[model samples]
Target: MKEISDSTIVDVHARRIFDGCARPSLEVVVTTKSARVCAAPSYSDPRSSGKYEIRHFPNGGVQGSIDLINSIIRERLIGMKADSQEEIDGLFLDIDGTEGFENIGGNTAEATSMAVAKAAAASLGLPLYEYASLNREIGVPHQMPNIIGGGATMGDEGWKGRTPDIQDHIILAVGCQSTYEEMLCVSDVFHRTGILLQEADPNFTGGRDEEYCWLPGLDDVTCLDVLKQACDEVADARGVAFRLGLDVGAADLWDEEKGVYVYLKEGIVRTPDEHATYLASLIDHYNLFYIEDSFFEDHVELYVEQMQQYGNRVLVSGDDLLAGNLQRLEKMAGRCAINAAVIKLNMAGTVTRTRKFVEMCKKNGFSTIGSCRTYDSPDDTMADLIVAWGCNAYKCGSPAGGEHAAKYNRYIRIDKKLGEIPTFATFPGVKP
Candidate 1:
């Protein structure tokens, strides 16, 4: 092996496109001094993969990452010693295995993976995830993100199935998804059929369409009506039972002063401290599964208090609270800060780091959800990861688009594939 020096070659680039599928996707390549190290990854939303692609870089995250690598490629090394990649990889231990990637620096999984991966890429000549997962069979794992919108028709409980590998969920809007009128319809159907419908996810987190749709005020007339209409239509169409949700991620109900919950930009202002009581009421009145970041990140303790008071009925969740950072999640979970957390992959560059966050969440008795990002859809790897994490409750829809359907479809396959799910739906250990 050799150490970094001015003379070490850093040339060569190769790439391939792994077709997309019902879930997430990936396009990538690898490089070496002057040869092809490996092939591209395989997984995509085959139809919509055109929406996303990976290349050897005319310029992008991958390319920019390489630039960063080049900058750090020097110094610390004292010789023109041409080193083998395995040897270069061995150097990671000397540096605490944490370098490059400031996006979310909390755990060892991400940073270590990043460092070793770069060496492997330098060795095998492949991109990150692709290279890291090289040669490993990439199977079509299941992905489900069922957003329970139509409250009464869907029911208070959405799903409580035997999880395959992973099963996490997101119960969309409470005002619309958990309206009393809708819950009764769902409950009646569940009672009549003697089916559990879907069990309310203790990890239920909330979301909104603010970033995707136009909702000026969460409590406004038009917004409230729109929310109800959205749920009403789903209940009529899907004819399935669902659960109530709290999607603070939508930030529509965001008021820095008043804190009363708003679905859209409902014009209610509240301090972080002001909102907890109202949120507590939202849970008590609706039997809500969860309220995510009822206030902003600064209000972590307030939300923690909400969980402290009523965690039994509803789990207070966090998305922005940790931003999918393993280290931050470590601190929060260690402190028993909140009841649940959301796992968003893109917040960190690669999947390795994300998994660490999931694992930590499990250790802390923290609940988790498989989430969708603001990016393009049809990438089912996320769905696979979700199922792998054993998170049943999902959030993969906003009334339209293949991205949502793609993951939802994956969930359908999971149930179909597993034959029958086991009981005891908890993260952690062996089969119950």
Candidate 2:
């Protein structure tokens, strides 16, 4: 066996790059004795509510992150084994020496950590997913593509009018047996939905959000209805099952001081109990496969109630609620507050931390959704992460845009390389 020490790091470089959303982001390159690799960290919209996210721009600009990585981070990482992921990551934490990466910045840590992992894999002459899998089975996860946009993703600058109160109206290719099939399923519905949008409003000018999801001037229910129609058409045409999912992102709609969920565009206000009831109604009416963050992060009781009612059938998931923090997942483990979670590597700050979060989810029997950020990087390492972590499903937004397509295309390549197609993951007690 080749010694991991043979791939010792020699040099490190960092630079500022524009993310998918045109925001400043950090990318890092690590040169090892045996190989060289680079990676960029994905970023969530700063507007999106998350309680545990590390400080993204620690030095006020992306340039500060670049400087820190090139100087202190590089100095520390030199001569360290690229395959010593845990030790190197520990060094990163110790160097920062603050909770939530308050000093070094999570983006800097994430970019550096991923670059090291890739370097290790390259040095070993193994595929990234195979190396990261840690001797576990590499499975192909189903795709969760956003088909409609709302909330923070939608803005008043372009389209005819405001979008629904929900943040992301997504679709799951639950019935597809292969990642390639899932891509086809998602893309079919996405294009059909666009056609339907154009028909619904003659003024619909192909407006979209950062993720390339359609921005139609429709209410939440109407968006769901349109999505359902498109999915139904594709299901009938392809003879496969497709399911609807939602990211209510209730944090944005939550009026904390007033103690109510406000829907400015829909012109409605819902109390906590009322909002729970409304969500239940949608679950029944639409038969949704997943519902994420229907209640705000602090509303553990509401999430518990939702889990109790539909946890077995629906993936009552947490994004803002859990915030990809292991501690938060632990608090909700036995409480049954959530049965699923969204795993964004940036939210966790390091590759080791993200793997720990995924492990905890498995221990609690919670499905994981490897998700992309609103402001994502072109790096397709997330696709490899999905396979390595054995995520049940993954979100790469719509399958159209370059950033999104990069992930899907990479996953498809991995799926093809695997000798046999992996079994598709589905919600408990749900057919699709």
Candidate 3:
């Protein structure tokens, strides 16, 4: 067995920083006897988030979270072992003493927990991912980059009196052997998709949403068609295969009061079953490799039905449905018909719990995808997390933007260090 270091933490510090959207967020640094590490929590768009999640930070903004971390959390954690991740995070739970981290703040707990892990990895002179897991077969996750945008991320400004209910239209480079190749394939598709959009609409302006998803004046189905045509063109030109994915974020369209999904742009309403059938048809029509949150978080039965019907053909995934919570994940484990779960570390409030959730998913034969927030800081921690724990897929928006590029750059660095091209996951068995 390899000997691990037992470095004791000497200090903990907290500060306020701005995320991608200039929203207030908390950042923390943990110092061990030999090294130090820092981290910050990312935020999701309000419309795309789960209904049951705790307050992102305390109501007082970043200052409140920093105050709690400095005054209450620091002293308790300073003398603990940095290498003991579970113990450090357990102390966070005890200090907060509230479900969903309503007291000390989820963002604070997440920043502190991740900082300690990074400090421990630094102390051991190992990469963050290597320190986090014993598995050496950590392959590169398939990259899903958003090519089109709609719903909450776009708001009402760019829709031109029409609202597309779907959240994101993404692309998958399924047949690429390495991260570099996958990136090239997606980049080509992104540019080609843009050219096609510009040609189709004479008044089209080059505008994008927060995640760099193209803001085109087209309905959901029309956007999918455009993306598919772009993918076909890119594949033929580059000699690589690609597929389409959707982050439907169905909760954004669900009407809790009326018990129907209101597609304001299409001018139609759908019950759970009608919505499921419509989504299934879309999957078949576009040959979608991944579909996320086809139903709202509370609609477990509907999710199960979709999973049963299409899990074999597509990655029936949950983002809003799971929201990185252990109890919710456990509820969907065997009972719900999901084949994959999106793991966003901060949403779970700690790296320890996030790993536990990934383990739970693996045990239940579900693939795990490490995902980033739409409103994120310029931190590459998620890049390390995905590689370190060996997730099956990764989603961090387009290759543009500093926040998104940070993740892609980290993966490129990792690939360079390995000196060997890493294998990528193939969904739907990569049709001929």
Candidate 4:
């Protein structure tokens, strides 16, 4: 067993069919066959509107920017040795130079690049993580069980037809138990909504072919009980430090009257502001790790107050605050507006931009977390980024979308490669 030679690159075409989206794809692995690789490998999910997303190409011919992914990628990838992390990264840089930021806005370059990595790993007979600088001591990542309600504001184009920027939050709770099992269950409210959850805009319902998810109605007391039970089970099985999270999604939510943010809206979930204290209390009670869109977007004062009070209890993350843009996050940070921010790929428009956003947030003492939209598939490219770029946490959704499953699989691969990581993964001196 020896280091893979940089002179050799492997090209292998692959196939993936998940959540009803099936197509033939290509993956290129660049590494030497002689590398004493521990494992040569490896590695999901979604979009917001019609403008984003790379469709599966079963016939091998797809339209849009995806067609820009040339078979030339195979040419540049072949004969590369996976001797070190720097070497592989350098390879990517060189390929990308000719390719040049081709994989932005759900571009096809993403699909092609992902496939190439997989092929390169297999060519070397080394696990993808091993050759790709994977750490083999990190145990699989753990996510807390908190329901997320996805509410979208409907109506209007500009300010004229623009209905309120609010959404109906239907809680979709994630479950992880002592048996190392993580399941996502919805409340009775979503159950009642039935097909309505799937019918977001009705006129513009994306992922029309995928299964719809929503929260069924339930009393706050019942929802609380369910949440507590799930929390208890997850904490006991995994470590309490594993983490819990929530996303209210404030872009569709707003508040000009209450002077509060969008999280206080009624008929969504948790009974508006009535449960703010209760929710905060629970967060404190359970040592919750992260909270997103808690008080709506742009409610700087509300967030300031939450941070002042709960700063020592949990991490209050921001999504709409920065809308996945670093410049916005920096502005918000300068104003002392948030503790954490979400990294949405489309929001940044490209992987390059997204990386900059993550870097900027980290510079400002913020944790960068990866996330997914409701509409998704078996594409784990983002999941791959989460590991490669080292996100604090990832919200790919309740294992429903094969996208979730795909990401979960990638995480498992990471854990297998890296081993178990130190339990010292907390906010640390941040007082969160």
Task: Judging by lDDT against the true structure, name the best candidate.
Answer: 2
Off by over 4 Å in 1: 1-26, 29-100, 103-240, 250-264, 420-432
Question: TM-score ranking from best to worst?
Answer: 2, 3, 4, 1
- Higher-lDDT candidate among 1 and 2? 2
Summing lDDT over every window of 10 consecutive residues in candidate 2, give the lowest-scoring window.
153-162
In TM-score terms, candidate 4 sits at 0.59
**Tens digit of lDDT per residue, candidate 3, span 29-88?**
888888978888886556667876665777676798899889888999877888888888
- Residue range 44-123, candidate 2, lDDT tens digits: 67777476567875776688888999999999999988888988988889999975888887878889999999999998
TM-score of each: 0.54, 0.96, 0.94, 0.59
lDDT of each structure? 0.40, 0.85, 0.81, 0.45
Cα lDDT tens digits for candidate 4, 259-328: 4433322333333454356557756665555667766455577677777777665667787676665556
**Candidate 1 lDDT, 61-142, residue by residue in tens:** 3334333333443232223222333333334223334332332121111222233334444554433324433344322221
Residue 4, candidate 3: C-alpha displacement in angstroms = 6.8
By the lDDT metric, which is better: model 2 or model 4?
Answer: 2
lDDT of residue 283 for candidate 2: 93
Better of 1 and 4 by lDDT: 4
Off by over 4 Å in 2: 155-161, 426-431
